[model samples]
Target: MTDIPLSTWAAMAEIIGAGSIITGLLVVLFQIRQFRVQQRNAVAINLAQTFYSPDLAQALSLMQNVPDGISLAEIRARGPEYEQAAITVCTSFETMGLLVHEKIAPMGLVLDLAGGIVSTMSRKLARWQEDLREEQQQPSWGEWFEWLGDQARAIKHEQPPAHIRLDQGAGGS
Candidate 1:
């Protein structure tokens, strides 16, 4: 076989090196995506455990006055033991738009679930409240109350009335 030219050998080496680097980068990206999915799952398990984890609730309660935005450091300050997990959970929650953060504190994190729930409930309650307002605007003694008499009868379905004694209260015919 003919000896390969030095330039050709060098070009082959470069191609091999570039291919390895690209392959390594793709592996790293895949690993990162897997890590994120695991982290999200962890957060979900932690959320479910919140019902039984008094510490979690206690820590979360500290966030009541956390203002419209906050940071991870603030969460860490609540309890040192859970700081790492808290930061991960908080960051995920923020990304999910479940919590809002005004300024990204160097270590800042804030849950925006309140914004979501409030907005949703506000719209729903507004409709209910509007119905209430419309009802109030009607003249007093609306037809709707006519159902009250039937409701009272249902409540008294069994036997004689408790308040009124038939033998004593009613005059014999």
Candidate 2:
């Protein structure tokens, strides 16, 4: 066989080097995507755990009886248990809000998981939350929770409910 020219060999070497670099970059990109998916999965699992916790379940059960637009004073008047229930619901949603804000959890996942509950609870607790901010002298109190509620409301308005979407044969709502 004839020997290859040095220039041709150099070109082939450059091509191989470039291919290797591209392959490395692709691997890195894939790894980054996988890491993000893993992170989201972890967040989802944590959220599910929180949702199923006894405290949250009890809080939700208690809050179901609370009327919309109930004031902080009204909650206090009911009993310590009512106040505790409100606090538990708020704190749980607050954590979820922070997670959504930080991109640790996707908004779509949150909306699908707890959109209606967030929307309803946010409305029910709006006055109480506002009063809490004033009483605590901290304007940022429950800010993320409010933000999350807003997101949930907006998505609720823009999209159909899961039952309707699912009936249409869509895999996800």
Candidate 3:
């Protein structure tokens, strides 16, 4: 200690300071990566809801209202408005082998699963934003509203076209 001069002490302090800066930068990078992954997962779940869930709901609704003995032709005739989206949905389900009653059983189950995914993602995002707010010591209202706007945009952009006319008008056009 006696041999060390004031210059050495200054240099040591600078090194420690630089080390801390590097550590902070690394933490920021890790956090950014984690956020990106979360956002991607959310987007993917949203895409699934857009492309699959609505159609599944419509199909299920149609199946429920149709008399067990009704002809497909009659059903189609009654559902002319839904022809395009319905056909697309039917084809998509057929390709995925999900159109069969035995396979799909309860469409509600599929919708419930999708809903759970969306709910979980929402909770995670809220928690993340809450943490960010706490860390930054700032109110989160603005960020929350912005996030909501983004979600609305995503839903608006991705929602499938209305299809499958329910006799009771269960599926809104």
Q: Estimate TM-scores for all models.
A: 0.34, 0.90, 0.35
The TM-score of predicted model 3 comes to 0.35
Q: List the residue pairs that clash in candidate 1.
A: 71-108, 71-109, 72-108, 72-109, 98-112, 98-113, 99-111, 99-112, 100-112
Candidate 3 runs further than 4 Å off:
55-80, 83-173
Best by lDDT: 2
Q: What is the C-alpha lDDT of each candidate?
A: 0.41, 0.90, 0.46
Superposition TM-score, candidate 1 onto the true structure: 0.34
Single out the weakest 10-residue window by summed lDDT for candidate 3: 96-105
Question: How large an RMSD does model 1 have?
Answer: 23.4
How many clashing residue pairs appear in each of the predictions shown?
Answer: 9, 0, 0
Model 2 CA deviation exceeding 4 Å by range? 170-173
Instruction: Give lDDT: candidate 3, residue 80.
Output: 64
Candidate 1 segments whose C-alpha is farther than 4 A from its true place: 54-173
Clash pairs, candidate 3, are none
Error of 2 at 16 (Å): 1.6
Q: Give lDDT for model 1.
A: 0.41
Best by TM-score: 2
Better of 1 and 2 by lDDT: 2
